[model samples]
Target: MKQIVVIGGGPAGVEAAVAAAKGHSQVTLISEGPIGGRTGWDSLLPSKVWLHAAELAGVAEHTAEGVAIGAVHVTPTEVLNRIKQVAQRWSEREAQRLQAAGVKVVHGVAAFHSPHELIVRNDDSQQTLTADAVIIATGSVPRFPPTMKPDGQRIIAPRFASHLNTLPPDMIVIGGGPTGSEFASLFSRLGVKVTWIVGAPGVLPMFDPAAGAALAAAMTAHGATIHQVDVERAERTEGGVVVTTADGATHTAAMAFLAIGRVPDLSRLNLAAAGLEVGANGQLAVDNYGRTVAGHIFVVGDAAGGPMLANRALAQAWIAGRTAAELSAPGYCPHTVVSAVYTVPEIAQVGIVSGGEGELQRVRASYTASLKAYLSDETEGWVELIYDAVNRQIRGGIAVGTHAADMLAPVALAIQTGATIADLAAVFAAYPTLSEVVFAAARAVK
Candidate 1:
C-alpha cells in the first residue's frame, strides 16, 4: 500500500486525506488543532453564519411581505457560542468519518525531518512517521503588518474578532477586502459604529467595479464610514485604540480588526529540507497538478498561493490527492474547480476572465429584473457572462447577488463542459428566480 501523509487539517487537508484514503492508500492526516480546518471553524463557515443572521436582521427590519419581527437584537456572545458549537460538531463529525474510512488522524504539529519523513509533536511527546508521498495543505493565516500586530485584546485579527464576547461600540476595520467588508457589515448591522478603511481605491476590487461600488454603497447605507485611499497604522491609546492614516489623520475606536490579507503558513515546514522550492511568500511552487519540485511531494490549498477560498482549496486538494493516489493506482482525471466568495451580495466566478483581444461575446442582466429579487426587495446585484465570439464557447461567468455562489455553479459547469452561450441560453431556469438572470445574460450575449 502507498503510504500518504497529509499535513494541515483544514478544508484542503481534510479533503485531500479523505480522497487519498478512498483510493485505497494508507493515509495519515495530521492537524495541530481540531480538524475541519480554518474554514470549518474560523473564516468561511463562521462568517456565513454571521452573515445569515445579519441578512435575517435586515429582513426583519424591512419586513419581507407580511413577516414582521418584534425587537431583534443579536448578542456578540451568542454569536460566538453558536460558532464554537458548530465548529466543534463539524470537527467531531469529520474525525469520525476519517476514522471510519480507515484514515489515521493525528493531532500534532508536523515538521519535515526529511522529504519522506515527518516529525509529529503534540503536547506530550513526538513521533517520526514515513510516507511514500507527502501532501502539504498547511493553509494560510491572516497577515498583520508588524506595526499593527494584534494584541488580541482591543486589537485583533479576523480569527480573534469572530469569537469576540461583546461587540465594540466603535470599530476600525483595516483592509477593505471581503473579510473586512463582512466584518464592517456585520458589526454595523449589530448597531456598532464601523470605520472601514480600504487601502485600495475601492472595496472588493477583485469583483466587477460595478459590483464593488454597489456593495460599498449597501454597506454605507447600513451606517459604515467608508474611507478609501486610506492606509491605517494602529496604536494603543489611553482611551482606546487609535488608527492613523498615511495623511496623519487619526481615528479612534474601541476595537480594531486587521483584515490585511493572508500569508502561507509554510515557514516551519522546512520545505527546503524536502528539496522543494518555496516562493518568497512561503508558498510552495507547484505545477498545475499541485506537484512540488520534489517528485513525491505535493502542495495544495492556500500554501499553493492561488485563490485562497475554502472551495478553491478543497478543489485543489481533490486534484492533488487524487493525482497523487493515481500515481499509486491507475486512472483518475482531476475536474475543473469552481471558486466562490460569500460576502453580502456574494461574488462567484469560474474559468479565466478573457481580457485580451478576441471575438468576445458578453452579456449582463440586473437582479431587479428577477421576480425573486423584487419579492425579496434585493434588486441591487447582477450576473455577467462572457463567451468566445468566434467559437461561441463560454469562457467565464461572474455573479454578484443573493445566492450568487449557488447560481454560479451552473455557469462553472457549463464552462468546464465547453458549453456555448447559446447552450446556456437554451436551458430553462425557474421563473422569477435569481438563476433566470443567468439565462437572461446568456441570451443577451451576441
Candidate 2:
C-alpha cells in the first residue's frame, strides 16, 4: 500500500486528502490549524453570511418594491459568532469523516526534508513522515503592499475584517477585485459610509465589461462611492485614516480594509530543498495534473496558481489526487474545472474562451425578463453563453444574478459534455425560476 501526504488543510488539501485516501492508499493530512481552510473560515462563508444579512436589509430599505419588510438590524457580534460556529462545525464534521476513513489527521506546520520526506512540527514536538507521493495544497495568504502595513485596528486585512464586531463610521475598501466589491457592497448595505477604490477603471475587471458596469451601477445606487485610480499609500490619521491616490488626492475614512489580493504561501516550505521549482510569481509550477518540477511531488489549488476559488481548488485536487493514485492503478484522465466568485448576484464561468478555429459566439440575456427576479426584486443581473460557431456547442457560460452559482452547474455541464446552444435551449427549465435565464440566453444565439 502506498502512503500519500497532503499539506495545507484548505479546500484543495482536504479534498485532495479525501480523494487520495480512497481505495488502498494510506493518506495523512496535515495543517497548522483546523481544516476548512481560509475560504470556509475567513473569506467565502463569512462574507456570504454578511451578504445574506445585507440582502435582507436591502429588502427592508426598498419596501416600495412590493415586499413588506420589517425593521432589519444586525449585531456584528452575533454575525461573528455565527461564522465561528459554522466554520467549527464544518471543520469538525470533515475531520470526523476523514478519521473514520482511516486517514491520519495531523495539526502542524509541514516542510519538506527531501523529495519523499517531511518534518511536521506541532506545539513542542516534531514528527517525520515518509510518503511515496506528496501533494502540496498549502494555500495563499492575504497580501498587503509594502507602503501599507495592516494594524488590524484602523488599517485591516480580510482575515481581521471578517471578525469585526462593530460597523465603522466610514470605511474605505482598497482593491476593486471581487473581494473588494463584496466588502464594499456589504458595508454600504449596512448603512456604513463606504468608499470603494478600484485600481482599474471598472469594478470587476476580469468579468465582461457590461457586467462590471452593471455591478458598479448597482453598488453606486446602494450608496458606495467608487474611485477608479491608483492608491499611493494609506496612513493612520487623527480621527481615522487617510488614503492618498497616485495623483496626489487624499480620502479620509474611519477605517481602511485592504483587499489587494493574495500570494501563494510557499516561503516556509523551501521547495528548492525538495528539488521543486516555483513560477515567476512564486507559485509551484504544475501542469493540469498538478505534477510539479520534481515530478513525484504534486501541487494543487492556490499554490498551483490560476483561478484561486475554493471550488476550483477542489476540482483540481480531485484530478491531482486521482492521477497520483493512478500512477499505480489504471485508466485516469484529467478533468476541466470551473470557477466562481460570490458577490452580489454572483459570477461563474467554465472552459476556455478561445478564438480562431474554435472561436466562440457569445449569447447574452438579461435577468430583467425572469419572473423570479421580478418577484425576488433582484433584476439587476444577466446571463451570457459562449458557443462554438462551427460545432454550435456551448463552450462557456457566465451568470451574474440571484442563485448564479446554482444556475452555473448546468452551463458547466453543458460545456463539459460539448452540449450545443440548441441542446441547452431544448431543455425545459421551470418557469419563474432564475435558471430559466440560461435557456433563454442560449436560445437567443440563433
Candidate 3:
C-alpha cells in the first residue's frame, strides 16, 4: 500500500487524508492545531454562525403589524460562546470521523525536508516521516497590506471575532469581497453604524456587477456607508479608528474590521528545502490535478492559492488524495463551481462556458414575476440566465435577493449538465417559489 502524508488539519487536509486511506493507502495527517483547524474553528464555520445570527437579528428588527415583539438585544459574550460551542461540536465530530477512517493524526508543525520527506515537530518531540506522496493543505491567513495591520483591539480580523465581547457602536469594514460585504451587511442590519470600503466600485467582484450594485444599495438602505475606493492606511485613535482612503479622504469608526483577503501561510514550511519556490504568483502554483511542479507533491485548499473557497478545497482534496494512492480521479473543471454570498438578500452564480462561437443572451427577470416573492415580501430581487445562442442552452445564471442561492441551484446543475433552454424552461418548481424567478428568466429567453 502507498504511504500518503497530508499536512494541515482543515477540512481540505482531513478530507484528503481520508480519501487516500479509503484508496488503500496508509495515510498520516499532520496538523498543528485542533481538529478542523482554521476552517472549523476560526474562519469559515464560525463566520457563518455570526452571519446566521445577523440574519435572525434582521428579521426580529423588522416590526410586524399587530405584533408585540420587543426590541432585540444582542449580548456579545453570548454570541461568542454560542459560536465556539457550535464550532467545537462540529470539529469534534470531524475528529471522530477522521479516526474512524483509520488515518493516523499527528498534531505538530511540519516542514518539508525534501520533496518526499517531512520533519514534524511538537513542543516535546521531533520526528521525520517519509511518504510516496505529500499533500499540502496548509490553509491561509489574512493578508495585511503594507500600512494596514490588525492590532487585535481597535483593529481586528474575522479570526479575532471570538474576542468580540462587545460590538462596536460603529465599524469600518475593508475589502469588497465576500468576507467584507457579509460583515458590512451583518453589522449594519444589526443596528451598528457601518462604513464599508471597497477597492472596486462595488462589492463581490467575482459575481456580476449588477448583483454587487444591488447588494451595495441594500446595505446603504440598511444604514451602511459605502466607500468605493481603496484604503491607504488605518490607525487607532483615542476613541476610534480612522481610515485614510487612496483618494485622500478619511473615514472614522469605533472599530475597524479588516477583511482584506487571505494568503497561504507557508512561511514556516521552508519550501526551499523541498525545491519548491513560490514565484511571481506569490504562491506555489499547481496544476488542475492539484499536483505541484514536483510531481510527487500536491498543494490544495487555501495553500494552493486561488479563491479561498471550501468547495474548491474539497474538490481538490478528493482529486489529489485519490491520485496520490494510484487511483483514478474524476477530473475537475474549474468553471463548473458555483459560489454563494450569504448576505441578507444573498447572491449566487455559475460561470458556464460559452457554447462554441455564438451570441450570448442574458435573459432577465424581476422578483415581482414570482408569486413566492410576494408571499415572502421580497419582490425586489432579480435573476438573470445566460443563454448560449449557438447551442440554445442555459449556460449559466445569477441571482440576487431572498433565497437567491436556492433559486440558482437548478441553474447551477443545468450548467453542469449542459441543459438546453427547453430543458430548463420545462423544469418545474412544483409551487409558487423563488426558483420560479430563475425559471421565468429561462422561459423569457426568445
Candidate 4:
C-alpha cells in the first residue's frame, strides 16, 4: 500500500485522509487540535448555533396568528456551553470515522523533514515519517492590520465570537465581506446596537448590487446602522473600544469586531524543505487536482486560496485524496460552489454576480410576486438571473430571501451542465415554495 500523509485536521484534511485510506493506501493524519479543527469548533459550526438562537429570539418576540409564545431569554455563556457540547460530540464522531477508514491519527505540529518526508513533533515526543504523497490542508486565521490588534476581549475576531460571556451594548464592525456582514446581521437580531463600517459602498458588494441593497435594507430595518467607509484605527479603552475612521470621525462601542479578512497559516509547514513556496498571489496555487509545482505534494482548502469555504475545501480534498491513491476522479469547477450568508433574509449567489466580458442579459423578479413569500410576510426579497443573449443559455443567478442558497442551487447545476433558459423554466416547482421565485426569474429571461 502507498504510504500517504495528510497534515492539518480541518474538514479538508480529515476527508482527504479518509479518502486516501479507502483507495487502499495507508494514511496517517497529523492534527494539532481536535479533529474538527476550526470549522467544527471555532468558526463555522459555533457561528451557526448562535445564528439559530438569534432566529429563535425573533420568533419569540412576535405573536403569530395561531401561535402564542412567551418571551425567551438566552445568555452568551449558555450558548457557549451549547457550542462546547456540540464540538465535543462532533470531534468524537469524526475520530471514530477516521479509525473506521483505517487512517492513523497523530497529534502534533508537523514540518517538512524533506521533500518526501515529514517530521511530527510535540513537547513530549518527536517522530519522522516517509510519505509517497502528502496533502496540506492547513486553514487560515484572521488578518489584522497594523492599525488593529485583537486582545480577545473588546477587539475580537470571529474565532473568538463564541467565547464572549456577554453581548456588548454597541459594536463597531469593520470589513464588509461575507464574514463581517453575517456578524453585523447576527448582532442586529440579538438587539445589539451595530455600527457597520463597510470599506465599500454597501454590504455584500461581491454579489449583485440589487442583492446588496436588499440586504442593507433588511438589516437597517432591524436597528443596525450602516456606514460606507474605511477604519483608520481601533483601540481599546477603559470602558470599551474606540474606532477611528479615515474620514476624521471617531466611533465607540463596547466591542470592535475585526472581520477584515484572513491569511493562510502555512508558515509553520517549512515549505522550503518541501520544495514549495507561496506564489505572488499570497498563497500556493493549485491546479485541478490541488497539486502544487511539486507533483507529490497536494494542497487543498484554505491553503489553495480561492474562497475560504469548507464546501470548496471538501471538493478539493476528495480529488486530491483519490488521485494520490491512484484512483480516478473528475475535477469540479470551483466557481459553481454556492456562497451563502446566514443573515435574516439571507443572501446567496453562484457563478458570476456581475456582468463583464460577455454578452449578458439580466432579468429580475421580486419576492412580492411570490404568493408563498406574501403569506410568510417575507415579500421584501428578490431574485435575478443573467443569461447569454446570444444562445439563451443560463449563465448565473442570485437569490435574496428565505432559503436563498437553496433556491439558487439548481441554477448552479444548470450553469455546470450548460443548460439553457428553457430547461430551467420547464422544471416543475411546487406551489407555495420559495423556489418558484427562482423559476420566475428564469422564465422572465428574454
- The models' CA-based lDDT, in order, is 0.79, 0.79, 0.85, 0.86
- lDDT by residue (1-446, candidate 4, tens digit) is 89999998889998899888878789999999989998888898888888888877876775458887776786899999989998889899889989999999999999998999899998889999899999998888778888899999999988996797899889998988888988999888887899999885568777777778888888888888888888889999999999998888899999999888887888899999988988887799778998889998999898777688788899889999999998997785866888888888799888866756568878888887678887777777788887887887777888888778898889888888998888887876888787888888877765
Q: Clashes in candidate 4: how many?
A: 0
TM-score of each prediction:
0.94, 0.93, 0.95, 0.95
TM-score, cand. 1: 0.94
Model 4 sits at a Cα RMSD from the real structure of 1.7
Q: How close is candidate 3 to the true structure, as a TM-score?
A: 0.95
Candidate 2 local lDDT, residue 224: 83
Tell me the tens digit of each residue's lDDT in model 2 across 157-200. 77874678999989999988878878887888788999998885
Per-prediction tally of clashes: 1, 0, 0, 0
Error of 4 at 294 (Å): 0.2
User: What is the TM-score of candidate 2?
Assistant: 0.93
- Per-residue lDDT tens digits of candidate 3, residues 1-446? 88899999999998898888888789999989898889888877877887878777766766455666877876778888998898889888888878999999998999989878899999989999999999999999888987899999999988887667888889999989998988888788777899999885568887778888888888888788888898999999999899999899999989999998888878899899888999776689788889989899999988988788888899899899988988899776665666788997798787653344458877889999878777667888898888777887777788888878778778777777888888887876757877777777778877
Model 3, residue 1: what's the lDDT?
81
Q: Every model's Cα RMSD, please? A: 2.4, 2.5, 2.0, 1.7
lDDT of 2: 0.79
